[model samples]
Structure formats: C-alpha cells, structure tokens
Target: MAAVVIRDPLAFAAIYDRYVALVYSASLRVLADVHEAEDVTQDVFVRLWRRPETFIAERGRFLSWLMSVARNRSVDELRSRGRRHRREALNGDTSDDDPATLVPADTDDPVLAAQLHEAQKLVRAALVGLPADQRRALELAYFGGFTQQEISAALHEPLGTVKTRIRLGMQKLRRALENRV
Candidate 1:
C-alpha cells in the first residue's frame, strides 16, 4: 500500500480517506483548537503523500508511524505558539464531541479500520492499568504536549520524580503493547 501510494494519487487519497479521522483526532487532542488541528491534519497527510517511502515496515505498523507523525507535528505547533496555556491538553480533558468519536463508519478498508480500533483499545487499556501518578505524567507529556520540565512545574513535582514516572510508565506501556503495536 505504501509503495502504491507513492506512485498513485488515487491510492494516496484512499489512504487519506481511511485514516484522516484518526490523524485529525490525534492533532485535536493535543492542540485543542479546531482550526489548528485541521491545519496539522492537512500537514500530516500532505507530508505522507510526499514521502511515502519513509514508512519503513520493520520499524512498526503503518498506523503507529502515522499517528506518531501527527502527534509530533501537533506538539511542534503547540511549542511554536509560545507561552500558551495548554490547560485542556495538560489535564487530558476531552469533550464529548471528540473528533475520534465521529470517525465515519464507511472507511474504504474495513480490515484496516478494525485493526486500528483494536489497537486503540489495547493502548487505552494498558494506559488505564498504570498508576495514577504515572498515567497523569505520561498523559501530560505525550497527549498534553508538555516537556518534562514543564510537566514537573505544572504538577508541582521534582524534575527527577517526573522523569522517573514518565520513564517507568513508558516501559510498562511498551511492554504491554509490544506485540499489538
């Protein structure tokens, strides 16, 4: 699919149609602004279309790689804004109308969609199994787009303590999702 997408515009469009909701959801979760999320979504897809070969199969699954791109780009956008209060992101507060919940049911590839849905469940369950402090720290860093120092200050913890929580949380998460992701 990646090879086909690199040479065929229609194939790229099909990929976009299948995964756009997930990509947009990742951005919206971090940015917490509709317009900015939309912009980041577009940027993600465009970059994928332009550089399909960058998706190395040995690294991990395509969906994981794509979501990483979306998350990183969203975080970059958040950092570029300088001195904005990411209250919603840092606190992991999501509204009822989260774009992820609104993903269209008629995706072009049902098998891929099913796999993605399963993957999301596994990741969420693993996250839920973590201790509260570790979960909060991980959420603030990844989903909230905060630096380790920023998270320490926001949560009123020592920098080393915050680092330890994030590192241990990540090790647990990686072990839990190693086979699935």
Candidate 2:
C-alpha cells in the first residue's frame, strides 16, 4: 500500500481514509484538544504524501510508523507552545481516554479497536514498570517532545543524565514490547 501510495499520490486518499481515525486519536490523546489534534493529523498526512519514502517497509508496519508520526507531531505542537498543561480542565472530558471512543462510531471495526486498546495497555504497563527517573525522562522525551537538553533544563538534571535515562528507558521498553509490537 505504501508502494501504491508512492506511485500514485492520489492513492493516498484510501490510506488516509483507513488510518485517519487512528492518527487523529493518537494526536488527540497527546494534545487533548480537538483543533490542535486536527492540525497535527493534517500535518502528518501531508508529510507522508510529500515524502512517502519515509515509510520504510523494511523497518516496521506502516500503522506503527504513522502513529509515531502523529504522536511526535502532537508533542511538537506542545513543545512549540512551551505549555506543559494546555489541556482544558473540564470535568467531564473522558472521551480522549478510551481507545474505543477515539475510533469513529461509523467506522468501528472491533478487531482494530481491540488492537488499539491492547496496544495502549501494553505500552502503559511497560512505562509503569520502569524506574521513576527513566519513566519521567522517557515520557518527557517521547510524549512531551522535549530534547535531552530541554529535558535537562526542565528537570534540573545534567544533560548526560537525561540522555542516559531516556536511552535506558527506551531499551527497556523495546525489550518489553519486542514480541508484542
């Protein structure tokens, strides 16, 4: 499908239709703002359309790569604004937390929905199992889109220490999700 998308840019519509919900959900989970999430979703698709080769078939599944892009873009939006707590403090906004709710009701495929829920559980579990310092560093880097220097500055830790924590955290996460991912 990536090959098809690359060969025919117009064919991207099909891919986008299939995965936009997941991408938007990934962004919304991080941004917690519908407008910002929509912007990130559009940016992710545009970048893919312009640079289809970025999706290397040999590296991993397209869905995984696309989700990473969506997440990173959402984090980038957060970093750009320099706001750690931008989400609204509304009392009844639990929609973003449920994987099933993230998928549109019209396109609700139980298998894919279940897979998303399972993946979220697996990742949350892996993150929870890490040491506090490692988990914080990884969350800041991956979820907050902060660079090592930025993390060091924000956390008041040495840059080297921040880097080491992120590296160790990633290694552990990779090991934990090796078979499942």
Candidate 3:
C-alpha cells in the first residue's frame, strides 16, 4: 500500500477506481442530494490524494478508513446545511403556502404527482400506526428538522433513547410500508 502511495501511479489510480463508487454512495446516503453528494465525493478523493500519508494501516483497512472519512464529512455537510435551512425558516423569510418552498410545484407528468400523493398517504398511515413516543420523535426529527440532541432536549428524553426510538421507528415504518405496497 505504501509502495502504491509512493512508487506506482497505476496502483493509486486503481485504488481510486475501486473506492470512488463506495465513497460516492456513502455521501449520497447522508446527503440525499445528487449534486451535493457528487461535490463531496470529489472532495473526499481530492483530500485523500493530497494527504495519502495521513492514512495509517494500523488504524484500519484502507477502504474502511476512507469510508469513515466520507461518511463523517457527508454528515457534517448535511448538519451544516440543515442548520442554515432552520435558521432561514426561523427568520420567517420563507413563504408558508408556497408549494415550491415545500416541494417542486411543477411535475413533468401527472403520473409523478399521483405516485407522490400515494407515497405521502402511505407514510402518513405508517406514522399514525407508530407508538406516540416513537411517532413524536420521528415527527420532530423529520418534519421539524430537529437533530437527535435537539429532540431529546425538547422531549425531555435522553439523547441515546431518542436516537434509538427514531431508528427503531423508521425500521418498523419501512417494513410496514413495504408490506402495504
């Protein structure tokens, strides 16, 4: 690996080729926005190229270390953007009834609107089925855009418990909705 870092150009290129997709996918999972994910993915590789000496094999496998960096960076980006979005919302600079503010108003076709409406109904039903605490946690985190720590403070629950509830609630919701669909 060190030889690849120092002596062989093709070996470094091979490493990038092997790991680029994994890094991009990890970024996409955290970001959920294609353009932002793509930008972050490129940045991750650029950082790796600039600081190949920073990666120590003793800490973990190369891909594992790379993935950890990618995931952390993506999450940090999301949290930063989320904070900015919440600040904007709190300032009341946004229009409440603007469809564009919530979701894109113009769909390319009617079928897309029907599919979106159906998905919304299924999600609503799933939320209604959750236990009150779990539902509240999910709502505050998802709709209100509160972080787990914020939700814990707001609901007077431990941060770990709030995170667990949200994770479990989402797992159950996914299963239930899968069966329905």
Candidate 4:
C-alpha cells in the first residue's frame, strides 16, 4: 500500500484517511493546540505525498514513520511561532512598548543598532527552529516568568520532561548559534 502511494497520488488519500486521526492526536498531544495540530497533520501528509519513497518497507512500518514525521513537524511549528514573537518584540511592537522597554537599541549609533538587530534576528530564528517542547519550556521559564513547577502544572507535562526540554533546548540553541559563528 505504501509503495502504491508513490505511483498513484489518489492512493495517498487512503493512507491519510487511515492515519489522520492517530497522527493528529499525536500532534495535539505534543502541541496542545487544535489549529497547530491540524496544520501539523496536513504537513505530515504533504511530506508523505511529496516523497513517498522516503518510506521503505525494510526500514519499518509506514504508521511509525508517519508518526515520527507528525511529531517533528508539530515541534517545528511551535519553534517557528516562538521566533515570530521574538521578532515582533525586537521590533518594539509591544502593546505598551516604550523606548526603554525595547531590546536595547542604540539610536545614537545606527551601525551598532543595526548589528544588534541582525544578531537578535538570527537568535530569534534559531530559537524558533528548536523542538516544540523545548521552545515552550524556554518561553515559559524565561519570557513568561514561570517557574518549572508552574510550567509543568500549566502544561500538564511531567516535571522531568519540562526540565529536560529546557536543558536540551538551551543546549541546542547554543550549538546552533555557535555553528554560525
């Protein structure tokens, strides 16, 4: 069935219909957002439709491969959203934004301000590219001013998972920036 999907695009619909619920459920479990889950579900099927040969029978079951794609894509969406917020904040778009509240711009030195702005944008993009769990944990702990315990309760995730997400997320962010330099 998986092999046939590559040859015939219509057959892909059957595969999507069979696993859409399970895939969307896994996405919602990770993301906790209905709309994001739906987007992730659509993304997962799109990836399959575009590259059906990516799934080889010798590798494993199609369902398992599809599940991995769904989870990873949901996390990607989470990170992307975070980056967008970071960009908005840096641009001084807060509802109650004041000059002092902005991300430390140097109006007197346009070159320096531009450099800082570009660096911040790079960081924002990296932050948003992180895994969804890590991005959420970092946002809550750093920007949201929430304690780890509070985040765990609010997200209804295991305390250890929250801790691990933050730790891993930070490490990945650091590595991502370092590689660029």
TM-score of each: 0.85, 0.71, 0.52, 0.45
TM-score, prediction 3: 0.52
Per residue, candidate 4 scores C-alpha lDDT tens digits across 118-175 of: 7768887998899977987886654343568877877799999999999999999998
Clashing pairs in 4: 79-128
Top model by TM-score, which number?
1
Count steric clashes of candidate 2: 0
Please list the residue runs of candidate 1 whose C-alpha ends up more than 4 Å from where it truly belongs after superposition.
1-6, 56-59, 98-101, 104-108
What would the TM-score be for candidate 4 when compared with the true structure? 0.45
Alpha-carbon RMSD, candidate 1 = 2.5
- Pairs that collide in candidate 1 are none
Decreasing TM-score order of the candidates: 1, 2, 3, 4
Q: Give the top-scoring candidate (lDDT).
A: 1
Report how far residue 131 has shifted in candidate 2, in Å: 1.9
lDDT of 3: 0.69
Tell me the lDDT of candidate 1: 0.83
Clashes of each: 0, 0, 0, 1
Ranking by lDDT: 1, 2, 3, 4
RMSD of each: 2.5, 4.5, 10.0, 19.5
Model 4 residue runs over 4 Å out of place are 2-5, 83-181
Q: List the global CA lDDT of all models.
A: 0.83, 0.75, 0.69, 0.67
Q: Give the C-alpha miss distance for residue 103 in model 2, angstroms.
A: 4.4
